[model samples]
Every structure is written in structure tokens, then in C-alpha cells.
Target: MNGHALELGGIEKRFGKQTILKGIDIEARPGEFIALVGPSGCGKSTLLRIVAGLESPDAGRIRSGDRELGELPAAKRDVAMVFQSYALYPHLTAAQNIAVPLVMRRLSGWQRLPLIGRWLTPRATRDEIHARVRQVAEQLEIAHLLDRKPAKMSGGQRQRVALARAMVRDPRVFLMDEPLSNLDANLRVHTRSEIVALQRRTGVTTLYVTHDQAEALSMADRVAVMIQGCLLQLDTPQRIYQDPRHLEVARFIGTPRINQLDARVDDEGVAWVDGTALARCAEPPRDRKVVLAIRPPALHLVAEHHPRGLTAWVKRCEYLGTECLLHLELESDATPLIASLTPELGTAYRPDQRVWVAAEPSQTLIFARSGERLTAAEPRLERSANQPEKLDV
Candidate 1:
């Protein structure tokens, strides 16, 4: 079955005095994999529940293709949700679990009983259900485990059973709410690739919810970042990382977190950090304070006393074999800064060692006092007389 496009308009959810979602809007093209990601309590899961018809929105509407799903119960939405808990029955075998949807949907009430139901059910209908279950099991490579109950299966195997159950329906849309969260780290990584491949092969319109930013960035065609009940940005992984529209979006998408420094725009339209002029703002706020955000990779360690460089004392270092992260305390403003370096280069620095940090202006992000990103009309950097030459380390 082909996937259907999903559209969510003006989606709002509230619980008494608290609002969980605030007028969210999103559209997924047919067969697209969209990841909804945010920190805990950010309402990403609530939004996914709304899409699955498991939770009702106080306002807004959900549509799949031309059909509006606002009034449909969870069973009638033509959507299949693979929940985080696997939700497998302990007594049911894998094949039985996978066949539940079909059995419930296709069988009469009398045909659902134990021994009598099997005889009462049509021979053709029973064969079709069994054949479909086997097909799903084979596709998931779990045919051997069909006889094993969930109690005997591993987490990943049980997760596959959950997926197989969802796949058996061949629903128009797939909703996964942290389906891999229960897996161990290595298994989670392996299953991530498997899930992406499965989605591509099935071509199902999928909405995956997770609190892991890395998972969202690595697996999804597009990612929606929500925070405090608001959808902050929705775009490809590259754009979400490189061209975030808001300060909160910038702060949430990257590892080690983006560095924030207090900065100001001078009367001459130049942005300065710790008395060092870094770049020219497109629309400078005269003598107004602002926040400058720089990604860890964009900040390079330079030799001590480099011109226009900010002096920092290394407070700690974390070596991750492939690379090293230096935690620094800037002397000028006492702001914490982190710089990622190749292991070879990072090993040369030790705690309490003083160094200089410089940011590539083009990669730097400027935010207004209100926490909105400032767009540069022109390139942010202006060739400065004291600008340090590119460093090797």
C-alpha cells in the first residue's frame, strides 16, 4: 500500500491551565519520514499522540490526504502506532501478536472465540490471516520466533514483533513513539538503520517521536524541533543544524551545546565580544547588548595572545578517542566555552593551561536580547587589521 500525505493545521492541546501544544502546523509529503524531537516535557510525544488519534487536540485538525481525522476514533483513523512499550501480550506468540489487528478487524464476534471460533470462522479467512502473518514474519526475519511469546524474546525481537503487527495493517500512516528507546545503546543504533530501511522499503508516511536529537538528525528526511509546546523549526537535518531560526533551536540541536557569550553592537555597526570586534551586524542595534552563539566545532583554539582572540583557561578536557573536548573559562567575561579538537591537537592542552579562542564569523550566530536570531544582510565578517591568521590547531 502507498503512503498518504499528512497535514496538521493549527493543532492545539491544553490540560486545564497548562497548554501542551501551541498552534502547531506541519505537513509531511507522501512516504516521508519526519522526526518530532524535543527535550522531555516538550510535547513532542503529545503531538504524536494527537496524530495517532490516541489523544484529542483541544483545537486544530488532522488530515491524511483528503480525509479529515479530527472526529475519528483511534481504530478508524487508518493509522498504526508502534508504542514505546512494545505493548505485546505476554501469553501471545509472535505470530499471534502480529495477527491481532487482522483478527479483530476481519473476524465476527463469535469467530473470535477459542476452539469454537476457529471452527466457526471461514476456512478461507483463517488461511488468509495465517498467510499474512507468515509473510510479515518473514519480512521482519522473525519467522523462527513466531512461536515464542514475548517473555522469551529479546527487546529488539519484541520490537520487531510490534513493528510486524503494525506492518500487517499496511496503514496509510505509521506513528512511532520512541519505539527504540527500550533497546540498549548498540541495539538502538542498529535498529535505527533497520527502521529507516524498513520505512523506505514500505514507503509509509511515518512520524517518529524521540527526545534524542542525534537520532532525529541522523534518521529523518526532515525534523521538527519543538520546545515549550511550540514547533521551533522544521527542516532538513543540515538546515536545522546550520540555519536555525531561533536561539532555542540553535541551543538544542547540537552536542556539547552551542556556546553563548554576552556581546554588544557598537555605534559603528560592529559586533564585539569581550572588547574584541568580531564582525559587522547587518542591522546593528546601537550600543545594545546581544547574545552570540558559536558551535563547538566553529570555535578554534589559537596560540596565546593572538590578536582579537579571547583568552580562556582550560578547566577540563574530555577525550573521546577520535576527538577531544576542552572546557574553557574565558577570562574576559567568565563565560564557559567548549572547543572540539582532533585528538592529536587536544592532547597538547592540559587543565589550567591558558589558550586563545576565535570563532569563524561566518559560522557564528547572533541573537537579539529577546532570543531571536539576527540575520546578516551581508557576510558577518569584515576583514579586520588584527584578525589572526588561520591556526593549525
Candidate 2:
């Protein structure tokens, strides 16, 4: 534990003409878990790599605790990276893999000798190394699999080995770049909990990068949503979901994303989607259209002509075990909007069923055409969802 455990100030990176990380800035306190989330190729992994000293930033300073890592090599930074591919040496057994970091740091080049240095060097440090390896293996529940090589272990097991290797170093910060990507869906869920538990036990400040919104939302203390080389929103998981700063953040966080209804702000500062007034919002620019983002579960089916209800055309409906999803092809666009409905209520729904969808005035978000979100603007309609800028995904 230390002050400003990790910080990246004005970080910028470019690959040729393509700018990957544009002035990225973030901080992780001791014991903090900050997730870096984004769409594929949005520079999330690149940012993590830059922080790990694996990739150099064209600009900006990377710091871990009190030391500046600008001139330091990866080994000198005391930062450990648990890679997406596991990156375990297939020839080495699990124990050997976990011992690699300790071996590199503690043993002199010749001290790694098979017979000479092993018998001649000090024994106290070698015993400490064994104890440290055992501690991490026990923590990760890989003690039984210590002798198995990467080729014999499952993806989840391999992931644990990678984590244990990083753990043995007891670094100031742990940088994990999509460490769960290779596991099966069920295994991913299981491993995620394990990772969270391990982080708690070790109290290591972590920067976890992933493209999966659910992974970030469930695991992170705060999530930073990146897009096109910029971080659009960073907030608690619940805040990111309920109040998004940008339309792109709103569209990226949820299971089915959010349903956007085409609407225009009238002179009276009211927004009317299709033929119904969704909310009373301040008049946006005359020619620009506002997108009303409503969470699927936020709206309910109401009686036709009911106050604040929306008329939607149901295109397809899917029945999941506990809930059903209503896919409606809005008249505004070709993309079919999805709404998650509970099975208890989905009993009344059907394909091609015309339904009235509506939410409270405070449940919808209005956005400008360019994805710039306007939250404080006076609402013009009765059902507008007024929100503060946030990112949940």
C-alpha cells in the first residue's frame, strides 16, 4: 500500500497515423480495482500494455507508487501483467511457471545452476522462495496441480497459473489484460469470482482490461469506458448503467444495450418520439435530432392511449429461462431495439404484438446526434428521463 499506487498522466500513443490512446489519464489507489473497458480495437489493451512498460507511450508519464516508470524496464517497474493468452512456458510445470518471477528476481545468473550454486549458495533464501511459491499456489488453489504442465491443464487452470506467477512477485500493482477471455462462458464466470477474491486477499491495486461489459461491471470498483482513443465515462457499475455520460456509453453497457427512439425537441423544449411526447426537454438546436435512450426493463407495457405510453412494434420476442427479450423494430431505424422482460410478465407478450412502451419522466436519456449528451437541458415533454452524466458499462 502506498500513495497514488498507480497513475498515468496525459498518456498518448499513436501507431503510425492512427492515434490509439489519446491523452489517457487515470489513477489507482492502493487496493483499488479499476477496469478499463471498451469495444474491440479501442486501445484498452494498448493502454494496459503502456502502463505495464511492455509498450512505450509516444507521450505521457507512467508512475507506480512513488517511482517514475518512464526510464525503467518492465522488470524494474515491479508491475506484473497477467496476459490474455496465459503466456505460460509449456515446457515448464505449473510450479516452475509460478516460480519464474521469483527465480529471475532473487537468483543470480549463476545461482540458477543445477549442482554448483544450489549446493554452494545460501539456503535461507531458497527456503523462502519455496514458502512464497507454496503461499501463492495455496491461495490460487493450484497446489494440487503444481507439477502439471500447461498442456495438461484446462484454460481456467492455466489462467490461475498466470495469476499465481504474477502473485509471487508481490508487486505494487497487477495489470491484467483480459485474463478471462480464453475460458468457457461458465468458466469465465467462475474465474471472475476467483480473481475478485484473489484481489481482495492480496489487496493488490489492479488495472484490468476487457472488452466485455459484464466482466468490467461485475469485477471493477470503477469502470473507464474507452472509445476511439478517448475515455468517455468512468463511474461505478450502477452509475454507468443508470446514468451514462455519452450515448455510446449508454449503448455499450447493458446486456442488449439501450433502445434508442428517434425524437425531436420541439420549440417548447419537449421531445416527441414518433407521435407521442416522451419528455419535456429544452429545445436543442433547430435542425438537430435528439435520441431518447430508454433501458429495456425500464419501460412497461401499458394500455393503449395511456398517458406517457409509447407505441412500439414488436418484431421478435425471445424467451430466456428467467426472462424474455422483446426485440422491436422501431420505425426510426433499421436496428431492432431490445427490451428484457420478466417471464412473469412476458406471459402476455407475443410476436408481432403491438404494445405501448413507456417509462417515468426521469428514466430516459436524451442525446444529441453526435453522441454528445445533454442532461441538464430543460425537458420539454412529460416522460423525459433526466440524468447526470455517468458510465455504468
Candidate lDDT values, in order:
0.88, 0.83
**RMSD from true fold, candidate 2:** 4.8
lDDT of 2 by residue, 78-175 (tens): 88899999999999999999998998889998898878878765799888888899989998889999999999998889999999999997788889
Predict model 2's lDDT versus the native.
0.83
TM-score of every model versus the real structure: 0.94, 0.92
| Winner by TM-score | 1
How well is each residue in 285-369 modelled by candidate 1, as lDDT tens digits? 6447677889998899876665557888999999999889999998865789999899998888999988999987787788787
- Model 2: what TM-score? 0.92
Model 1 clash pairs are: none
lDDT of 2 at 189: 94
The C-alpha RMSD of each candidate to the native structure, in angstroms, is 3.8, 4.8
TM-score (C-alpha, index-matched) for candidate 1 = 0.94
